[model samples]
Target: MVKQNFILFMLIGELSKKSGVSRDTIRYYEKMGLLRVSANRRDNNYKEYADNAPDVLKMIAIGKNLGFKLIETKEFLEFWEQNDTDNERLTEMVLKKIEEIDTKIKALTVFKQNLENALIKCEP
Candidate 1:
């Protein structure tokens, strides 16, 4: 039974719809320890997820967009779960990611300049 205003338990289909993540991806996240569902199965034997599952999925998407690997995202989730006052660690990770992106952007810019030079050299 879902609690009122505290926790809303939803099946996989509802989670998939609300989170904008596919059922198969959600299942894979569960297998990778990136997500958790209630151990108590519904009468129909479907897994039930808490309301926060959607929020967690969104966090995963954001991490992926920032170039985090699945393992890194999982570690971030673990830090988030362990303490609310862990912003320092989270900030450090974000800063590191920013440095990596800066390096990639610099390399890509140089590569693009070389390609443009090659194109210019190709007469006609």
Candidate 2:
């Protein structure tokens, strides 16, 4: 079977398609310094994105999955970009995230118990 060549460079629209994020969201990320682009004003004039744009999008998705607000995600991304070699710091961040998740889980468990108790008292 022949392998298709993956495109390395993409325009904003194509990146949006590949990233599962709206163009406006990508633009907002760009404004917030979470993403960067290169433009070819001589030809197509549209912004050119790096092959790593997908990774950036994945980071955003991961942040959302971890219950981080956008601003918090931005700050985390900034820290990640600056401290690639600091494994200890990364571990600390991960531990903090785990703690936050634990807190949320406890709250959810309490809420579920309250709901179940109320349901047990309800008439059919």
Candidate 3:
């Protein structure tokens, strides 16, 4: 009795295949409140996800690409979906991430230079 336009529902394996995110990561995100908490439960207790789950995964990926941790990404997405005014809190998060990256770059540069120096010492 399903219509051609009916929405598709996917189980964890299908979602993992469609979204390219592992089932473990999906489960983690679901536990962490990033994905839909009320995934439709079948009589056997298996969860069914909406077709749009892939899009949500993409949003999470985009947030991580912006240097946000999983928890931060969830919070940022919530704030973004609900807020309209000045995003000072999000700005602060971005600034802090930038500072962290800067410190890491400095340490990495020093480490690279040390490695180069060590290699030079080994040259004949």
Candidate 4:
């Protein structure tokens, strides 16, 4: 069994180091409602973050890497936090994202082919 007392709450600085996300980015996520901080303030008045903050930040990073906008990421995170399982909404979003990626890949391939053709013609 996991120890109940093992939970760790970190300040934003510690979370930034662990998650490889900047403090400014974390604050922006909080502003955008993508992340949450505890209501309880520290002695110095800085907000405390739950141990899961790093995981949430990592999720945001992955979502961004997958081409999700902040609003889309927030929607997905909200759904995930509520359901903890995939649903039609999430599936639809993912399918749409896949289509977008496919379109971009096709365009990039065409661009690459054009560049290669130009380079071949220019060879001396």
Candidate 5:
């Protein structure tokens, strides 16, 4: 098959190995429309994914590492795949996530301080 420069069309197992995402998660991604197998491939029981499928899985992994929910990752992927998508929208999601993380950190800091104060009182 004539391949794109560095892109690879691969079955789920090879894709999973290359992408470090498991088969079950890849199936879940297909179910969620995060990944897709062609209709012919689906019908023929020959599931070959498009070349960029691995990249999508990597992006999902990055989003998860950044604490984005699955839905958020889906939205991010949709936005990213759009031809006219701009950085502003992506920045908005990331900034909002950072704000969320900051809020959680503040709450956790307060909780830790409260526990520390309680421990101090108990020690005396």
Candidate 6:
């Protein structure tokens, strides 16, 4: 079992170092609902971070890299923790992301064609 200190709370700086992600990225993930990061305010109102942040950030980064949005990532993690054996949902999510990628590829092809045309027109 992991120690309590590893999950209770940690300073943002430490979390970043431990998670191999930047503070800004962590903040973005929090905004996107990928992780829950609460602040521990000092007497002067400076903010700290909750522990377990590093692990959460790690999960978020991995999920995002695998094309999971924040919400999808959260659900995936939740289901993953519950020991669910069905992967139909996971497969669907991946397929959906692949569809999105296909759409992006089409859009990029159009843009590239436009750029090529513009370059040809401008050539002396």
What TM-score goes with each of the models? 0.83, 0.72, 0.73, 0.81, 0.81, 0.61
For all candidates, the clash counts are 0, 0, 0, 0, 0, 4
lDDT of 3 by residue, 11-115 (tens): 889889988999999999888988873344668888877777788899899988877799888877777657633688878877888899999999999999999
Candidate ranking (TM-score, best to worst)? 1, 4, 5, 3, 2, 6
lDDT digits (tens) for residues 49-103 of candidate 1: 9888998999899889879999989989888777654587788887888899999
Worst 10 residues of 2 by lDDT: 1-10
Which lDDT tens digits does candidate 4 get at residues 2-114? 12246567888888898999999999999999999877666789877888888788889889988999888998888877875568888888889899999999999999999
**Predicted model with the maximum lDDT:** 1
lDDT per residue for candidate 2 within 12-116, as digits (tens), equals: 888889889999999998998788776432164667777878788899889988888777777778776676646776667778888988999999999999999
Candidate 2 TM-score, true structure as reference: 0.72
Candidate no. 4 TM-score: 0.81
Look at candidate 4 and tell me the lDDT of residue 83.
72
Worst 10 residues of 5 by lDDT: 1-10
Task: Tell me the whole-model lDDT of each prediction, alpha carbons only.
Answer: 0.88, 0.78, 0.80, 0.85, 0.83, 0.72
Judge candidate 1 at residue 80 and give its lDDT: 74
List of clashing residue pairs for candidate 2:
none
Model 2 stretches astray by more than 4 angstroms: 1-8, 39-45, 78-85
Tell me the spans in candidate 5 whose CA falls farther than 4 Å from its real position: 1-8, 83-88
Q: Candidate 5 on 1-124: residue-level lDDT in tens?
A: 2143454467888888988889999999999888877544444576888788888998899989989999889989988778536778788888899999999999999999999999999994
Per-residue lDDT for 112 in model 3? 100
Error of 2 at 115 (Å): 1.1
